[model samples]
Target: MVSRTGLYPGTFDPLTNGHLDIISRALKLVDTLYIGVAINRDKGPLFSLEQRVEMVEAETKALSDGSNSVIKVVPFDTLLMSFAEELKADIIIRGLRAVADFEYEFQMVGMNSFLNDEIETVFLMADPHHQAIASKLVKEIARLKGDITSFVPADVASRLNEKFGN
Candidate 1:
């Protein structure tokens, strides 16, 4: 049988629960899932490229356990389509948390389609529990010493606290 590869790209400055949820859900949809860690300097990530990649790998490692699909963590600093093409991805998975995000993502889908219509982009709405979780918001809450345990994984929460010396 042929296999489908899905690419889920994000900066993941600090991998959040929402991201993991998407990863878990995405695994069910593809034979291989590539967690594309993007090097977006404009976002001014708190974590380094290597750090983000390592965290993503560590966090996603367990998601593939007992599953036939493979999950690879890759770091990229180019156009999203270029990275997707390189991986020969059959689909690009994107997590949408709210209606506000749809407008922007809608435009992105169009632009990406123009670049490569063959590679499809799939949108997965964040689970109800994770609908409010955003990496940026998580970072802010952590910086203020708020309880971010619910929004991020234990390891990531620890790292965020350490970053703010909490």
Candidate 2:
């Protein structure tokens, strides 16, 4: 039997509960999951790539339940489909939080299909509890001294607090 691999790529500026939800759910569908931390120098991310990767690695380390699947956090600075092909990922997992996100993601799916016809894209609806949580919004709230403990994981909240000196 061949093992299936899935790629979940994103900025993950600060890993949020919503991101973790997608990761947890994606794990069930593949034999291996790679959380690709996109290195977009244009976005001016709040956290460094290394920091974001560390946070994701720290947070997802426990999800590797011997028999289930393994989760790897990696940094990539290239077209997502190219990265997917490099990893030999069978599916590209994306999380949709709202209709607004769909419009953009739908376009991306079409473009990626043109780039790699063999790789498939999978969309997972955000859990209701995490629907409103976004890394950008969380950063803004944290910047304004708002409590973002509920939106992200404990380790992520701590890192954000440290980053903002809050």
Candidate 3:
């Protein structure tokens, strides 16, 4: 009786292992998970959208189990609720790592609910191991030539090393 499909929207400037944890957990909560890669240039990224998409695809290869596990990467250029509606997602999945994150996401949830009454957003707390992981932190570490092996997946770590390493 699995009948839910969810849209997880994020910039994912550089897909991290933390991001994968959210995706992996969300897969069990929904039949299909659409990983919406928001194209936001306001915050510059170490990797391009194409590179991020490839990294996401590569990291998610083992999770897609044909029927139940499905990860579709799509670029979102507009409002998240609009993208969710466009995808016909029954739910919107978000990850919450701290109270500060909740403050921001709460506003988004309110705005999204106003936009579409039928759609709901679910927030999953980041695993304790990944509580401090984020794209911003990852970028900063990479900029300093610091090891980010623990922050991102192996594939992502490799890509970051290639791009940021001299």
The candidate scoring highest on TM-score is 1
Q: Provide the overall lDDT of each model, using Cα atoms, as 2-decimal numbers.
A: 0.94, 0.93, 0.86
Each prediction's TM-score versus the true structure: 0.98, 0.97, 0.94
1 or 3, which is superior by lDDT? 1
For model 1, the stretches where C-alpha displacement exceeds 4 angstroms are none
lDDT of 1 by residue, 1-166 (tens): 9999999999998899999999999999999999999999999999999989989998888889857889999999999999999999999999999999999999999999999999999999999999999899999999999999999989988989999999
Best by lDDT: 1
For candidate 2, report its TM-score: 0.97
Per-residue lDDT of 166 in model 3: 30
When summed lDDT is taken over every stretch of 10 residues in candidate 1, the lowest stretch is: 59-68
Residue 78's lDDT in candidate 1: 92
In the range 1-166, model 2's lDDT, one tens digit per residue, is: 8899999999999899999899999999999999999999999999999998998999888777643988988999998998999999999999999999999999999999999989999999999999999899999999988999999998888888888899
The alpha-carbon RMSD values of the candidates against the true structure, listed in the order shown, are 0.7, 1.0, 1.5
- Candidates, ranked, lDDT: 1, 2, 3
Q: Candidate 2 or 3, higher TM-score?
A: 2
Off by over 4 Å in 3: none
